[model samples]
Target: MTEVTDFFRQGGGLSDTLPSFELRPGQIELVRAIEKSLSQHTHLVAEAGTGIGKTFSYLLPTLQHDKQVVISTATKHLQEQIFFKDLPLVEKALHKKVSACLLKGRGNYFCHYRYEMFLGSAFQLNKTQAKKVSRLQDWVQQTQSGDLSEIAAFVAEDYAFKKKITSTRENCLNSECPYFDDCFVQKVREKAKKSAVVVVNHSLLMADIVLKETGFAEILPETDVVVIDEAHHLPKIATQAFAEQVSSNQLLELGKDTLQVYRREAGDVEGFADCVEALIGAVDDLRDALADARPNGQVQLAKLKQFKRAYQAFQVLMQVFSEFLHALKALAERSSDLQKINERAEITAERIKSVFSPTAADDSHNDDTERQAAQSVAILEWHADYFKACRLPIHLGNRWQNVMQAYADSWLFVSATLSVGQSFDFFIDSLGLPADIATLQVNSPFNYAEQSVIHILPDLPAPNQHDFVPALVDAVLPILQKTKGRAFMLFTSYRNLYEAAELMQNSDFHLFIQGEHPKSQLIDAFMQSDNAVLLGTVSFWEGVDVAGEKLSCVIIDKIPFPSPGDPMIAEQSRYLESTGRSAFAHCYIPKAATLLKQGAGRLIRSNHDTGVLIFGDNRMLTKSYGRQLIEALPPARQVDSDALFTFIEDTL
Candidate 1:
């Protein structure tokens, strides 16, 4: 507490060093809690609202602490922000040297072996792809980090070209490769091993958890403190990491790799080539079976088994895959490269078999309870593009508790929106934290009531009603006209976004659609354009910060309830129903409330910022569940259309 106070007091640590820094009470309190938690080696759940200066608050204590730390964020942008921007400022303020490194997923870095292979196989690529590879080759020589994001000409949207030059876990060859010492991924990991603080994203953290020794083991070294920023996203990411999936693309790649390895080692053995071709054909057959069966949305594999064609496809795929594995094993005796490929192929086959096979009940071990718990929540799913079997843990608290107990000595979970109705129960239960875990909530210093207004349109139809979109467009048009399009029209779905875009197509305001440009570009264009209206879906709801008059209005289409039809949501609902609980009230509503809070938060970024938050959905006013949603938001004044108009007029 004394350390925190010294840093936060006026004319203290930061104020004397940083010219524009002003100590906020909330930030100081959070930093104190973090310091105490680290000292005691306990877990802390903190809901530090926007403007709490959460990054600096957590970072200062982390740097002051004598032990190694790992700070995981939800986005690469945030990872970079912490490493490049926040860390430097904190180090400067403290006047102490702190070593920090930023590490992204391996695919982000260029692989020399893969680059050479890609160049050798240029004849297989189209002219456009060849040109892109040529440009990448030039950049590879000049780039220091070897990170693909540095190449201005390399558009990651072109997945094929990107994959051609990047190394995947299956093909990396690891220590066997000549470039192992100079490998960009290896170099990053080496840096992370030595750095006092390592910055990574949720995906990389999850990879370390799941892959253990094989993957990110080197990158995630033992650390005294582990801080998870954007902690709300952890549960979902953890569930995904632990889940199993078998896709046609994976099988296709396996077949292609086997062929390449066989050709390099055995010079195209007749029977081996035939087996590889058969394996590829089997993959195509499974895809055709899926297409013919038309699993239009995500269907449980159990349900899909009722469709004979799909069932037959599963059987055929399993048999062919087994045969392919046997062929690879036989070839493995001849070539070490083929042996490694065979081992990988065998692992994939086993995973696919496990998805098809029924789980064996075991009563001997207590650990079986956890396994059964996960199995109970698991769903085998088939979508239009891929097939997957995953566990969507409804309550992550126990799982997270176990993870922390096993791996970390001290843990801090920080997020802008972690509480509902001023209680952390919803977030706590989701993360499986015990009630006694140290909890803190710091409301944003921004004066929301003075800086923004929550304007809910009245008498509009429900989202399911046919006229909803039209009525929404009608209701928002005048507000857009009043504000002159310095607004974000956030929708829950692409359908709504497209419908709104169509209606607003003839408007004088400069319109920016989500998919029309990259998100960063769209934000840049929006900021640059006078009176620009940006129409986007879920991604725009969070991670957007546009202060001042460049953006003054945020219009949300409806309550952002998770789609009830989603496989994960449906399974969770079923699990809740079995236990005689209302999933809608407990799960759906709280999730929507959290999202709504995020959307409304976009309006007032700073104390000086003023804007109107418009919810086109009438449900916030008409629905019984609406009150809970409103309660979770910042305490902004509710205003009618006339008041909204007057407020906008006065502010702008």
Candidate 2:
């Protein structure tokens, strides 16, 4: 064994220093592969199953190398695990000193400027609100770590105030602000600068690369490695970050904030009234045009685009005042007498510019740089982020791509659902990975043939059919009896979740519904309850681990495929079909296979765990694609519906 592996081994040289742990062959192979790949600067896609010890597998090699590495995960919980629990344990095991730091997005930390605004909002309140605000004030004064998530009770009571208080990227003053030295964000980055490993979430990682607003290069330019855990989430995250969004509510907030600044600075000044009037009128005109154009469910873009054209023209009026405010700030910079008024005016003008900058076309597009800048116009027509005539195009896939390229030192994209049938082509294509990347899949460690039972309910109603929910309930009733109420009833839609929860409400079984409680709390309650059935949607299908007797059965309501009418799906389908390809076979079926595998994965959480998966949807048995889906699941016993209950009882 290598020195690093020996350090991590149980009862080895560093046993007294490091946490006791084992290194399996799969994990060792993963580490060796990563070490080899990083040395050659090659890309890798490793499929490490749940029991493969993936965490230590990568960390040991990373710590051994004389390089800086950044690790990112899908959730804050996992980020904390790597930084707080896993990294410390591994470093101790190796008997080496490796600096590490944890960083989150800017909004999590307290902004002195916004906090000041929050303080004003607190005092300008009624009796009950004042008492609550006072408590918050006291807490804010004492908090060493100003994470918003720490303020548990306040989030539930004062959501609006909380939003107002959260610091935004556009509004931060950086070095010019009074709180720059005391800033939590800066402090964390400073720590990251000295550390070899920096742990962050996928969203923040994306913001650093694509948004270019997070200032990642300032710390990461010298870094040699990056690891992205939960690689499956990268594509969707990319699309969201790369895309832009503008809503009516956003414009209203901008106007309100500008109005507040105007009132506070110039005491209902002359130019302020005209600016606010034009802003409100322009927003109203767009809303009216949109309403008249589309008397439908969601606003259609075709009509909104026309409204945006007129809205852009109306936005020019604010530019006149903005220029005047700019002159005032320049004058105030020379004289201290008008500093406060000048500064406030300058801030307000910039706010207005941010609102309209995305839509307004630049006349200075002669050079290559300017042309690139002019081409990327934000389409959002409302709020501080909107332009007049364009909508911000939001692409979630691009956002994910930026993250993988940015902060991660080594990204391990692992999921039981990453492949469709026998191919990883769909997911790989979606991720936009470079050619010559290395890929590996470790077959599930479970003895699927001995432990798992897959039974597909054939000839069932369509998922959207009215009888589907009743039929699904009927199909699951016997399965639940066999397992005696220890089951996860996974659904694809809210309607189905509601129906399932209501149908099983009074069965002397604890019924938990999604959105009724915080997800973690709901899971904890379900695990603690002896006989409980949790009814949930997509998120519950994956990233859930309930081992031992707590989870004995998994009943899928139906196959989850993107709805045809969804705007993104429609656009993608049109694009693909235009290229003369079958979207159903190439796109939809493969996508369903991956999601189905994720749902089925919940059945077998550990080596000691075993359960029956009942896919209530009839398509699995009747369709040719059913074979692929069944084959994708853990190697479970194949049994007819009649024998499933007896099998569950016999296994237990």
Candidate 3:
């Protein structure tokens, strides 16, 4: 077989196979390093910058390797890009037949059982939902895989109607479900099992790994190689996967299900209605206790209104419920629903307990990593009408190490934003990888010096100033005029985004504001418009791709810092401070810089792509940490505000 690295040479397989394939030394180096890592059965951490064809560099080697590879990325967009776009190109380049599958989290697939249930409840929906969902009725019959993304001109994300007609861990009935044989999730899982390359998102990948160990319905086949793209996100995503959460919604559903199940299966069972009444009372009491919660709805348990007292009562209530289930379990054998209800009750009670009571430090493992993993914080969050109490892991460094070690022999972590100034120490240490783990950083094959410039918007007020957002809008207005709104105005928070959106609402150029439309539609509108500017928060900082004249500039509102008010970040910062660490240096700077890099990367996506990246945050010039942030991004030329408009004009 031809060597995988040779596929990148000047007259190599890719050159011959792809007319546009250029010989990139950085791509070749990355491929050679990854191939060596896979062949040797060791761990590797690589930072493959944009325009380096990072996808192909990893795909080619993993495809050639004689092992089943599970490629997990941060987003479904990239997963589809790799499987749909990158994979086929590599296969053709190598002229080798390969099998690949794209498996999303279960909810992405349509549920026949729920669809029928939804049809029954269709009368209750308002006219708008009724109209939108009516389309799915016809499509469901003809669709084979049942993946909603396959449906054109339909939005399935973050829609409450979609949730009601999809499957969740709490709602799924598994083999007992009437539609078991036709389960879309099952079909995809079987596909994933047989394919050599299974592509999944980080959340699904983590869930599968954790679920497989517990002997649940497994999602992937035995994994021989695990390649993590956008690996920087794994630590954050892992904490969510490992954390225990119990919500009022869960309790309410349990009560409703128990009542219905009792009426249908065990009418003679005593205490069913009374137990449900107690559950409802418990939920009310818990919610009433939070009546004085901060308006933002994120409160540290200790700061909550009579939280300690309410929590104590809540714990006792769960205990009583658990006791009721224990007694009920005696008659649970009378029906499978009864048995399942009993089990669900027990699990909910345990989660409530675990979320509230984290274990004290255990001396069983003197390792610092273990000690950090053991530290956890409990938080109360209100979402719309319900609240979820979650136990969040302080850090995932050691826990992630164990997961990677136990799951796959060859572990490869790659991302465009894995390093800060050529040092992968922060990324490595945060992930708890050893210092000796093979490390590689290859700059983007695109020439940043020739293709892009960073224009730090001059004389802007400090971000905390009440008038700062206005200043940002004022400073960037002329640039938008020059570029004619063919730009992305990214913000760190909605405050900035809203302020900018309002200011630009009357501009001659079209405005595609985030939250006004789905991210996909907003991006689509921006791409299709002749003169339009897209305004978005942190979400738009990355994962946006527009080439040629449609996107000629990226105007950032501020340094993209993770909000301190964020419950998880707050708890982690508090924990780090308690251990005498500088949370800003250890936690804040690296994360913010990486995010800034991602935003800057939105420009100059291809070698032919060129644009001006304007930073409205004055800190990029005044603060000491600003230098580090600049270095973290591609080495684009730094210009003062005066010259930036001219640069934009020339580039466009």
Best-fitting candidate, scored by TM-score: 1
CA displacement after TM-score superposition, residue 11 of candidate 1 (Å): 2.2
- Write down the lDDT that model 2 would get: 0.67
Off by over 4 Å in 3: 112-141, 152-158, 215-217, 267-271, 274-296, 306-331, 359-374, 574-580
lDDT of each: 0.80, 0.67, 0.80
1-652 per-residue lDDT for model 3 (tens digits)? 8888888888887888788889899998999998888888998999988888888888888887767799999998889988898888888887888888999998889999877766664558778777766778778878888998877347555476666678878767789888999999999899888999999999999898778668755778887789999998987888777888888878876776677667777778777678677777777666665553433366655444446655555565556667656666676788887887777877887886676544221123336534433577667777446778787777665666777777888989999989998799888867678778999999888888888888887788899999998888888888888888789988888877898788778878898888988788888878989789888888888888887778888888888777797767887788779879988987899898899899888888788888899887888888899898888888988887667767776767
Q: Stretches of candidate 1 above 4 Å error?
A: 124-130, 155-157, 213-218, 285-296, 306-312, 359-397
In order of appearance, the predictions have TM-scores of: 0.92, 0.82, 0.89
Ranking the candidates on lDDT from highest down gives 1, 3, 2
lDDT value, candidate 1, whole model: 0.80
Q: So what's the TM-score on candidate 2?
A: 0.82
Pairs in clash, predicted candidate 3:
none
User: lDDT per residue, candidate 1, 477-537, as tens digits?
Assistant: 8898998889999999999999989988998889999999899999999999997999999
Clashes of each: 2, 35, 0
